[model samples]
Target: MTVIPSLNVPLLGVAVTPLNRAELLAHIRDAVQEGRQMLVAGHNLHSVYLWYSLPEFRDFYDRAGAVVVDGMPLLALLRIGQRARLRTEHRIGSTDWLDGLADLEGIQRVTLLGGTPAASTAVLRHLRSLGGDVAWQGIPGDPWRAEDVDEVAEEIRAHDPQVLLIGMGMPLQERIADQLAARLDVPVIATVGGALDQLGGTQSLAPRRLGTMGLEWAWRLATDPRRLAGRYLLEPMKLAALLMWRA
Candidate 1:
């Protein structure tokens, strides 16, 4: 097993590994070499809320092989509360690293589950353009549900890919990735929320500069306030109260 050091955050009742993108990919490469099935998941502010609010969500995270720190806020809290040595570069958004998976030495076949047919096509095209021996395939999973787990697993198993990337948002993706990791022999099963859409150009990624400065949430809020205002504004307050109460 590739043992990445993790720090416990009592505030969120979760553990986060401070890994930059290269380190994460190296870990994934090691997992592939060891022939181990690993679920690569991440934690952002929204996931922190779900981690506390939903039992299944918490369970899924508890079982993840790697739970990377994905948001600046969560990274800050981890440093402040845990008194760890995490740096700004430790916050790894999935969009920044998805492309690198194609270059993994032992990975030849990758299957993606999630996004629209068009979006999946776009992602596949981009991955193919990377000029690797990796065979890429995408299955449309826009309306994935709990009942579809078995069928989805079957479809992924049929592809016989070495890597599986689940992009269905949130709890759903985590749910499916957990089940698939248990059912399939894929070396790496990644729960990448919205990464497919962003890679496919269906969703606009926030400017890289904003992300580096920890203001991507502001950009997302500005772009889609109706969908994200509560997530960016109200949820932090709730998370703060939950942390204080737990503290």
Candidate 2:
């Protein structure tokens, strides 16, 4: 196994790896070709904070196939801290990566779960445009309940999807994917956040320029200040405090 460099956050045992976007895609492609089941997860600062403080969250990441570097700020800090030997030019988001996969013919039948109706619809439209054969479903509300599980599982099994894409946002999506993997025989599952919104036109993505600069979070905050401002600003501070306390 390849060992990424260690991150020294207080109470956090998370590590940064040398892997970049190309490496990530290559691995996923290989897994698909080999017919192996895989799970891909993306983590931002909020997720990092939660993982450090929550045993269950940490366990989820520990079991994931690839826990990616989703936030530019997090990647920058990792590079500045020299915690990982990652390539400075390597940066990619989950949405773009998934879009790329939509073009590949060997990806197998795909199922999309989670996200609001509009978001899921948009993602389905985009994938169809790319000529992929995808099995799509959108949960109208929260999918954490046991009833939701049975219903979603039945749909997934009925479709017999080889790959599943879930977009319920952090921890929740990850937990759902984990449970689905245990309960079902799907080979690959990916947990993506807000990707459906961007695809569906419900949420606008940060401009390419801002994204390149790692200020996409600011754009998101600007677009949905009421929804994001408090969480983004306060979560990091809380995570930092938790880390310090652990130390």
Candidate 3:
């Protein structure tokens, strides 16, 4: 059994295990090969509140096979406070990982959910351009309806996609994945917030150098100040609170 170290982040309200990129990839590959259902979560403090406030969202995390760390701040906290033995070398955002996955052949069918129709279309086109044999589907609009859940699940089952990528953002998408997980036997269901926008060209990712330096948040804030100013600016205050609580 591989022992993964748990990070002590009080605000998260759960023991977060640190799995290096390779370990994470291997875990997903093994899960797919074995035909076992898995839920993948990428959550921050705000998203954590979204999960705790919503029962459905909370249940999603509870059922996930793995919830990898995505936020740079979260990684910093883990490294500094938890004394974790993991390297903070790479920031494996779900969108980047999915693109990399697309390059690999004979893996599994991928179903994309969430984002606007236009964004979803771009995602499909990009994946096809990458020579990915993915079976893609998109929600009609931005916010998905509960009624559409079953229909989406039915389509996914018919396609039998090994991986389901939910981009509905935060608690909503995570809740949807949890509900759908109970109804279907899909191998991997990933809740990736705004990744579709990044993949679809509506939004740009931070340059590789910025990402490597853990300043990707700054890049995002620079790109859309009006949209991300409050979220990114206020995140530090929340981090302070978490650190105090841990102390």
Candidate 4:
């Protein structure tokens, strides 16, 4: 059995567990069967930066039931520490969870709460293609707001999905998942960030080779400089600074 440890990034208020694909799926099944509520978040390097720089992000992560390191850069850092010993072949992520969830038995319905209409449709379609033939549904949404909470929650309650995936992007997804998990009777809710965006053919992710080398940030920055330049270029400096201060 793989023991789960909370890899604390002190001052940032994030406690991540080095949970690979297998462990995450098993944990979710157990949590759901026991009726245990979970506010799970997948954290990457950019997530770490946001968690530290944005107080709200930090707060949500701190309150989460489980946080998993979802990017290779963070996984590389963890490999140097005693907090975890994850398999090197893959950086387990929310997408892996989708596969894991799909492989399991008894997930009747799944409600997706974020991403554009097209992305939601594509992702749902893909998830349904998985082995268990999971029914992937969604609550139609656009540029989201706190006021939409009631509507979203009502939709979730109506669907009563066994699983909920929120891909509303970083802080917003985390915030919305936290709010929804508080009131909804759903079995499990995971804040998957932009994992659903991969479904949108337009939102191409970095290639596997680059990702394995922990250079996915570079690929993203190169492709979308206007949007991700600062994120990929400057935010990692904060991580280095944090490490230096800790040392």
Q: Supply the TM-score for candidate 3.
A: 0.84
- Note the Cα lDDT for every prediction shown: 0.84, 0.70, 0.70, 0.72
Q: What is every candidate's alpha-carbon RMSD to the true fold?
A: 1.8, 3.0, 3.2, 3.2
Instruction: Give per-residue CA lDDT, model 3, range 1-247, as digits (tens).
Output: 1223445554456545566566666776777787776677765655555554567766666666676777666676676777665555434677657775564444657788878788888888777787765556555438577888788888878877777888877767777777787888878788888888888887787776776677888898998999888777875566556556766
Q: Candidate 4 lDDT, tens digit per residue, 12-73?
A: 44567777677777777777767776767777888887876788888877776677877876
Per-residue lDDT over 180-240 for candidate 2, one digit per residue giving the tens place of the 0 to 100 score = 8888987678888777767767778887577668888899898999989876899889887
Candidate that would win on TM-score: 1
* Candidate ordering by TM-score (highest first): 1, 4, 2, 3
- lDDT tens string, model 1, 85-159? 888888998898889978877878889999988998999988899887888889989876678788878887888
Alpha-carbon error at 242 in model 1, in Å? 2.0
True-vs-predicted CA distance for residue 200, candidate 3, Å: 1.6
Question: Each model's TM-score?
Answer: 0.93, 0.86, 0.84, 0.87
Candidate 4 lDDT for residue 7? 78
Error of 1 at 226 (Å): 1.8
